[model samples]
Target: MRKSRKLAVLTGVGLAPCLVLGLSTTPASAHGWVTNPASRQAQCATGTVQCGDIKWEPQSVEGPKGLKDCAGGNARFADLRDDSKGWKVTNVGSSTTFNWKLTVQHATSTWQYFVGSTKVAEFNDGGARPAPNVSHNVNFKGITGKQKVLAVWNIADTANAFYACIDVNIGG
Candidate 1:
């Protein structure tokens, strides 16, 4: 019985390294990637944009972060026209270089930008032949903490209806 016990212990010890190696060999999923502001960490959250009118006020956030996946089976947007349908920035901290992810459901949809109440940028489909879903990265440099950032989807023929979700990193 002692010999059997020893053999079992040895077997367990021998398998430990293999188990560790096997677990370590697996590749991790890249759902969201952000740059860490401190330690010059390359991973962090610049910002996130969701579809619909923003109901909540923008909240400050810190640390490396990523936008959550769309919820309620509906895409999200920023600066929604309706007061009840808009996006909010949470855990926002002082940084620059906004990294955004935008997915347009309709080809006629366009993404509009604003700094506070002033319009800054506008992204249009530009009559792309194949009107399908597309992703875009928006960079807003020289952004201050007090300034408000807004992105909206303006549809051409569909009552300004479009869906968009974005994540931004504010570090260079």
Candidate 2:
């Protein structure tokens, strides 16, 4: 897997090369979470929902890709998988916008949105990288009622990905 880091400054002349090498050091920490629809992490971060450590680092709900769990299969943030957390549900129409708040942007493979087992929408980042905030217009395809919109951000250079579950009430 490829890694990268940004260095702010070098104090000594001899540290120039070291500082340059640091540039290739993939960030030790990468973080992001869905905010538009207020994912579990978002609710935790905002104190709208009480949670564990995840409340301190909402953007860090990351784990191996391919898992459908709201916590991305990570045990620490598994509270996200609980449906009784009182997460705020955004009332969305047949189509609505989903926004992601990124604290540490990483090279991405794709962004997928799923309703139940069916893929409702997707945006391919193609590993082109990502902005501080990523937004996608998702089409619910007539799926209605209270449902969990699982959003996955697949990373290009790693075996892991970030996960966010937005509780949504679909209707008008």
Query: Which candidate gets the maximum lDDT versus the true structure?
Result: 2
TM of each candidate vs. truth: 0.33, 0.82
Writing each residue's lDDT as its tens digit, candidate 1 over 59-147 gives 11111112222221222312422233333432343433333222233344455555555555666766442223233354454554433
Clash count of each predicted structure: 28, 2
Best by TM-score: 2
Score residue 88 of candidate 1 by CA lDDT: 42
Judged by lDDT against the true structure, how good is candidate 2?
A: 0.87
Question: In model 1, which regions exceed 4 Å deviation?
Answer: 1-104, 129-133, 146-148, 163-172
In model 1, the worst 10-residue window by lDDT is 35-44
Off by over 4 Å in 2: 1-27
Weakest lDDT window of 10 consecutive positions for candidate 2: 1-10
lDDT of 1 at 95: 31
CA displacement after TM-score superposition, residue 37 of candidate 2 (Å): 1.2
lDDT at 26, model 2: 80
Q: Tell how far residue 66 is off in model 2, in angstroms.
A: 0.5
